[model samples]
Target: MRFYPYKLACLLAFGCFVSVTWIKSIPSDEGSTVMPDLQILYKRLLVAEELGGQVSQDLSSILEQLRNLSKTGNDTYLYSVHNRTGFKVSVVLGIPTVKRDKQSYLVNTLSSLLFSLTSSQCQDLLIIVFVAETNLDYVNSVAETIMKNFPKEVQSGLLEVISPSQYYYPDFTSLKETFGDSKERVKWRTKQNLDFSFLMLYAQDKGTFYVQLEDDVVAKSGYYDEMKAYATNEASKPWLYLEFSQLGFIGKLFRTRDLPMIAEFFLMFHRDKPIDWLLDHILWVKVCNPEKDDKHCTEQKALLKQRYKPSLFQHVGLHSSLPGKLQHLKDKDFGKQTLYKAHNNPPAEVSSTLKHYQTHSLKSAYEGRDFFWAITPLQGDYILFNFSQPVYTSGYLFRSGNIETNGDKFFNTTVEVLPSSVLARHKVAIPHYRESGNGFIIVGEFVNGLAEGKIEAALQPVSALRLVVHSDSDVWALLSEILIKV
Candidate 1:
């Protein structure tokens, strides 16, 4: 098996990783604490010399499999991340999923991950998806979906799917009495931990770092690079894991060496507590052994950890995975939304209202709040993204107001991409997007209060992008979010 040494995974701008000063502007002063991912290239690169020149055969097999994935289309097993990632195979993003619900978010999440990776960071990582279903029939069905949607990634070895057997779980009969009132909830929670333990064990052979993720989280562009930069720079800090997210256990980066003990803790108290609480207890036991107060235990654990200010991941799941459990979460948009480079602060004057906007306000429109209120409507109002220079943009994404919260706010919403200088020179119009009488090209139109449909055609060399209301009404027009993909 051939092992390739890895460079530091911190490529920021196109050519090379930009200086920490890459973020130049922001869209809002109030709201979620959005800050640049405080990353600087590491002084000490994880080179073969740091690992004493050779790696374990298990890690060797894992890297070889990833390398060969592109050629042979094979999969390899792996486990936890290491305390420090120096040169050796470092991170394996582990996703443990159950098919309790048919509307799976794995494909969307996988697509985001694929789109977010920089060229250099591609080889430094692998994503392992665990179809942790006890039922073989259901497992096979889920596997088929993954194969159908991401055949290329699967064939190239970027993704691997696995299902651990039921026999791998530890017996929990003794702990049944612990869940006096919430038996079903305890059972569900305990099984999730057991599944996580099995996933760690199964994939432990792959790399030194393991990132925990849910099946339904979408990430900001360049998330992997930011995560790698954080992991690389935080090696010297007294930290347990670099938390790339604040929602649930989606983006916690764990060390491979910690998995055996974590899995053991889960097995010992599977029916006693939730996985997140159990993790805190495990850390407390290491620090203040035999600790009692919940506050002290939690604080002690917090002291040893660090989390990114603006999280890298967001939970997009609305429905619950289990019965009687609610799982709706608002999405946080960071990345370029903070810089406001494309003019997101106070959009040009629109219809009647200029200010007093909170939900569906101009600022809120671009706050990266996925599914959050977009700019509401007023009479004759239009929101425009006036860039400093005309940019070549192909597509745009816009979701309507939450259906339950009056999707009627999306009635007659329109997306327009003005032709660029290049297009002006050629005098060519997009086949579907005809030049409207108002001197703008209309690329997309939504009748209902939803951007929830097939994507429209791409717009090229656009100097500006705008959204307008075709209907004149006093009702609020709520936008979920918008993306101008170049």
Candidate 2:
């Protein structure tokens, strides 16, 4: 669509002119610089044919509409009528330890454009600019200069700068606990930096939604509005606002009321994984099952079958070349086949220090098909369910209870036939499988007694067996001699 050049100039007392050009092709200062007539400005930029590029169609259109309003000499009325339905967004600027000029430019441009567009809507909005502990002084200086140079409408409480530590600052303990060791300090720091800034503004601002903008992202025209519309439309559903790019990560968005639930979910599931991985997991799995009940697997499987109908999301690889595109494959092409081709070498030998149990008694009772027992002990203080087979697709460990010496039923359990020749190797370990060249590993907690203790799968015409362990925890188990029936 049509792209418009935005130029902001700062005039010094010495008659020296400092101009910042938001767009590359457009000159910063042109003509007498009499506040650049909004009417002529709109005419030159807002032709339907001019709005053909993807870069700034939304900005051009909004500007064009404002130009038309000004041209009609109704500027006073248009300015007086408030437009607050649009989404109010803000960017929290963290200190830049290593200055990347390009990133800074992008951040400035996005902030400028976002502020400019929202202003045109005449909506009551607030943009809280935050600087973090790392480069607080530098960011503060930059924000001060920018604020002083900002258009009057933007400067009048519409765009405000605040320090992250001033409000909603998370302590070191919480940061360490949320992100683990100092090894991933940068990522954790960045997240905290943004988290505090966004949350602080969100708590004080009265708005339909709060948009979190990073310092390095470039926004297309209408980006904020589009996001706002999406948030509004999908507010009823368990939806998240995601920017799918090469990064393949989804950004967080929710009603003000859902913040706690969203935060709790993030904390529980995103302990060790990257933010994007966690988002992908949620989008791919949890969003559809907000309750995260144990039955999600079957529901998800049926949903996928119905939704995808005949295809999978490309080949079953963790990093697919085509991210937004989803494809389906035949049973043979499914990624589960790769599970059978386990890493021939086992993970570190199971720790002998932990207590172990024998399955010989149970094996003798069920002698027909090839039998295999996969056991995963509970972690720290958590006990596990003792079950042999996976009864549902949602990865919950269900114990058959027969393995317990007392024969006391631990929990009521159900069983569903393996839908696509896929089997659960360990009860608690996150499920790992390959479908049509796509490989994925899930993150889950598995415990013994409450865990799926053992299961039997029929492998016909098989001469050798391969076991693949995908858990971060070492697979510790006792295996009997391979039993083959002719």
Candidate 3:
């Protein structure tokens, strides 16, 4: 039987580990106090070493990994950043990605993480995308896609893109096939272990806690808040890591202080087994007794890893990153996400030409209780919201499709408004207004499943609003959010 190095396990088992609180007090501009992560001090220490001091052991190991890759006078890592927002945060979410043979889910995964995050939450969190590939073209493509889709996040320092140097990966053609895995499988798992180690090392000093995530998963809204609350509440416990998602290595959270040990363990036996199996061995090394019964060992190992209820992430990618592999893993505990957002819309008579799906009626959506889902819409199909009386409107927002049903959205749809003033309603020939045949002026249109705009003063005192579908939709349409500012 093959096991990880006994020396590594013995070192961790007998090492003197220092425990510290995750939060540190920082002074605010208004003389109030804010709780930032204490790991900021660790980052400062690393900076000091650059000035003239001994590099820490953890950093030394990271340098060794890069050095072993045949140094050709290239930098160890590349970064895509607008500005370094170096402020301390509560959590660092690390995503390691490689070139997939099939469709890529990285963008959708990012959208789910970025959705519903408040400004304060954005400031408190950092999402690092580690493109674990040696190919420069693929890495650059990933960076460009992220920048194009998440410009605000990249500029605000909420997100970052990084890749190891082109020379960082070792030649895997010679890796010995182990555990009945094909040579390709051995190479894949071995590289995965290395990728995880590099990401963990890079994030160790960046936050109080670090979360491991894949590039093909959807996150629950408010995941950051839930994770912080749960971890802080369990700070007194002796758990080694907290599990936010039960599938694979998707949502495992660890303290920054423990990252060095974890990364070292993974690097020690990276080629021997899969990354998940290596993680399990770490738990066994820390707690299991050699002479104890198997059940006793299992119980003891369970104490070091905590599992959170109702997993906050779900795997949605069917094509695995590995070539020709399919992944259909789902988290049963994730339950269901909120499909619609309720808003206090003004009183209106809701009706639609399109057939409603089941009980999801337009009136229910207008009343701020449920979403509106309709069968495939044909050209000229329309949803009308006629107010009881003309009202001054400030703005309007219509968001289609929920997180889960992202594909079911109204396509080629226009948002038109009917004015109460007879003169304005009759001004169809005005160059600024594109009037629909039903006395409504086109104001906006759904682009990428969202339509939002401020209602111009000229269009105030609107009597009604309408969504006109101009083309037949391929799939059913769902209206998840409908907001009318009065």
Candidate 4:
């Protein structure tokens, strides 16, 4: 692969320049600087790479492509929104997300991916969240959400959030419809290609291997160890990539050394096909012959890639990022999941208006032996935890949805607490909290399938804790975790 380098003066200027200083000369119509500090951040990256040992040729090429794209595409410059410096890990996972019309699974996906990694594995892995949008507000929202949810991971440099510059994408207004797809569909696939290419190129130099993932997938526990072990065992083979999930481009792993070629290939035909088809084409180009029969070509392409059974990731998002589309795709190869976690808690009587699914009952979930899977919850459905005694609870955490049933989570559900004092005084009005219909005080609501926070001191010696469903839900609900700290 060829690399583009900056001049010696630019390299030297980086050493002297303490901060990015904007120069105003013939400002544009938007009142933006005609020539901004595009090279400053990139120059610092090159310097950091050089200091580490040697600058990556693939990274240099990608940086040059961004600079060129910025010049022609949009006025805003390309930059990382939330990032940690000095990272070189064994594996880098890239998740490309777009603004969805329905609920976003990004947070749940992230939580699951980071849930099982140990300290050693955390050090050896890096996760990059590529928000594939030009809207600053949306990008910032994702960054903030990630920061709030995974503060430790963000601080420890295990997770990074980045967005492409507005100038990174070409105009889609002039795209021609192809493959019987609508113009909008064609544009969506085309932009997806660009997004994958950009993410791959950016991750190429960050780790020894790169794994592609969607923002709506849940990873199996111990996925990192399993993938690494399998890849290491097959290190001597000449395979192009390893498939960890049967679904389209969910857990595809590739060598970082080959990313330049792979990313270039995707960029070359980005407008022609979907990202997954383009990937298969790469395998075809490497091993298949044009004159061969379809069966022969398929056999040859199969040799270049290996598929592992019991998929490590599963797709759960029902709503596609593409507007007005729904995706019900699931990975059949993904095996069973840990439906619930075992925890010791104070004795309490558990009752629910929601009907449980199969053997997964509310009593089992409260006892910490199994998850609580219920049918579609209707308005006024509630899960009541009546304490055997008035315990001084300090905090509580209720997590819905397991790895296998990721979408089956409580929606618009509030966690309410009934004070022991409420039993004595009927219809007591709490100072700050709103009282529910049955004397329970609304404390917190489930956000992104998780309700976790410290209980206020004012609500001490709680008599009961209740989860009240405000609206009816289409999908069933599942509670995988329930913890109450006393």
Q: Which candidate model has the greater TM-score, 3 or 4?
A: 3
- Return the lDDT, model 1, position 23: 33
Lowest lDDT 10-mer window, candidate 4? 1-10
TM-score, candidate 1, is 0.52
Reference-based lDDT, each prediction: 0.58, 0.32, 0.79, 0.78
Relative to the true structure, candidate 3 reaches a TM of 0.68
* Model 3 poorest 10 in a row by lDDT: 1-10
Per-residue lDDT over 315-335 for candidate 1, one digit per residue giving the tens place of the 0 to 100 score: 877766766666777545333
Candidate 2 on 1-486: residue-level lDDT in tens? 111111111011001100111123333445655455675466446542243232233323433443343223222111111222224433221112223322243234323334214334434444444444335456455554544445443334454433322322223343333444453453454354334323422332235454444343333333445555555555565444432122222123434444433433343333345545554455466435555774775555343211111111112222212223232322221122110101112111112222434542223212322212334423331122222332222222322222112112222212222222234322324233222111212222222213322223331111122122222333433222222122
Top candidate, metric TM-score: 3
Tell me how many clashing residue pairs each candidate has: 21, 41, 0, 1
lDDT of 3 by residue, 1-486 (tens): 111111112122112111111123222356646435575566545555452222245445444454332222233343445424345688999999988888999989988887657668888898989999767777778888888888788877788776765445566887899889999889999889878987887777667899999999998867889999999999889988999999999999999889987887776667689988988999999998999899999999899999998899999999988898898899999999887888998889888898988999999988888989999999999999999999899988898877777778888999999999888777666576688786789988987677888777876789999999999889999998899998
Candidate 1 displacement at residue 78 in angstroms:
11
Runs in model 3 deviating more than 4 A are 1-84, 343-347, 351-360, 373-398, 405-478, 483-486
RMSD of each: 18.2, 25.1, 13.8, 14.1
Sort the candidates on lDDT, descending order.
3, 4, 1, 2
Worst 10 residues of 1 by lDDT: 9-18
Model 4 score (lDDT): 0.78
TM-score against truth, every candidate: 0.52, 0.34, 0.68, 0.60
- Candidate 3 clashes between residue pairs 3 or more apart in a chain or in different chains: none
lDDT tens readout by residue for model 4, 1-486: 111111212222122221222222212446744444565556555555554232234335455654444333233222333344356788999999898888999989988897646568988998988889878877777777888777778777788776766556776888789989999999999999888987887677678889999999988877899999998898899999999999888999999999887876776577789999999988888888888798999998888899998899999999998899999999999978766777788899999999998999988988888999999999999999999999988888888887767778899999998888855334445565677776677888987677887767676788999999999999999998889888
